[model samples]
Every structure is written in structure tokens, then in C-alpha cells.
Target: MIWVAIAISVCLGAAGQIFMKIAMRDAGPFPGLIGVVDIARYFWGAILSWPMLAAIVSYGISYVVWLGVLSRADLTLARPMVSLGYIMVILYGFYAGERMGWERVLGIVLIMIGLFLVVRSGARV
Candidate 1:
């Protein structure tokens, strides 16, 4: 059950990141950091975007599930598990037409290796 919550949290976190990326895909370049009005306008646009709303909801669900996970597991174990989100986000980004350079592929490999080590270490105890 705790593992299920952990998995849900990781998936939700990744989904939230993907949705936020989608929401910002067409937002153009940032209008500099000089004006409050420009910032407000940007935020208002984000608030009205369905992808942003979905990201918010996904984060909320992830947070709730994370709370449940914390109650059942050590923070050390659970925190590393969240790194699984990086793998999911990378895959989703690839599916979304983003370029996947060698660096990113290496990063994904390292993350997978780290996750394996962490999980393996946990199993030893």
C-alpha cells in the first residue's frame, strides 16, 4: 500500500511537470524582470490555461499521496524514490517532441542507476 502511494506520487509529480511544460510551450519568451504588470499578465495567462490547472491538480494529488508515504516510510528512502519522476518526465518530454540529446540520455541512465542502487540498498536492510 505504501509502495502504491509512492508510485502514485512519482507519477503525479511527473505528470504535473509535463502539464506545466505544455502550458508554457507557447508562452513565448519571458518579458524581462523589470515590470510588475508584465509579470501579472504572465501569471494571469497561466491561471487561465487548462494545462496549468491540470498541473496544479496533479501536484495537489501528489502532495496528498506523499503525505501518506511519509507516514509509512523513512524520508531517506522515500525521497530517492521521487527521483523516478525524472525518468517519467524525460520519456514524456521525448513523446512531446522535445529533443533528446546524449547528455539527457546519460542523465537518464545515471538516474536509473542511482535508483537501482538506492532500492537495492534498502532491500539489504
Candidate 2:
């Protein structure tokens, strides 16, 4: 129940990040402090992208589920659980052909260790 909701929230958050990345694949470099038209064009393109739409929906659902999770679990415990999204997003990004440097790998490892410690401490409560 509560665990399921937490899992769903993490997954949805990761999915949203992946979808956004995919949607931005073709969107060339940012126009750097450009005109309003450029900004509008960028946002319009994003709004029309199916992947972006999916990302928005995924994030919306994740937020709702996260609220439910918080209602049942302590914030100190549940917040660290959201770090699971970092691991999932990194894996998905690597699989999707994004750069995977050793630094990123090390960061992921650190996040995993932190998450483990948090969960373990929470369980003792």
C-alpha cells in the first residue's frame, strides 16, 4: 500500500525526467537571453510535444501519489526514498545514449549508499 505508492511516485518521477529528456532531444541549443519570441517558440514546441505532455502527466500523478505517501510515512523517511528517482533517471539516461562519465557513476553510488542508510535508520524507528 504505502510502499506501493512510494514506488509508483519514484517511477513516475523518473519517467517524467526521461520523457522530458527525450522531448528535448531535437530542441537545439537555448537562444541565450533571447527575445520573447524565441522563448515563446521554445515553450510552444515543448507544449506540442507528446513526450513533454506525457512527462507533465507523469509528474502530476507522481505529485498526487507522493502526497498520499507523505500522509502515511514520516517526511524524513519518505523524502530520502525519492532519491530512488535519481538512480532510475541516471540508468535510463545512460541507456538512452546520454554521456555516462565516472563522476556521474560515483554520484549514483553515493546516492544509493545514502538511500540505504536512510531506509535502514527509518526501519529501526
Clashes found in each candidate (C-alpha, N, C closer than 3 A): 0, 0
Candidate 1 Cα outliers beyond 4 Å, as residue runs: 123-125
Please list the C-alpha lDDT of all candidates, in the order they appear: 0.88, 0.88
Tens digit per residue, CA lDDT, model 2, 11-105: 99999999988888756666777899999899789768999999999999999999898888888888888899999998998888889999999
Give the per-residue lDDT of model 1 (tens digit) for 76-110. Answer: 78899899999999998888889999999999999
Worst lDDT 10-window in candidate 2: 116-125
Candidates' RMSD to native:
1.9, 1.8
Clashes of 2: 0
TM-score of each: 0.89, 0.89
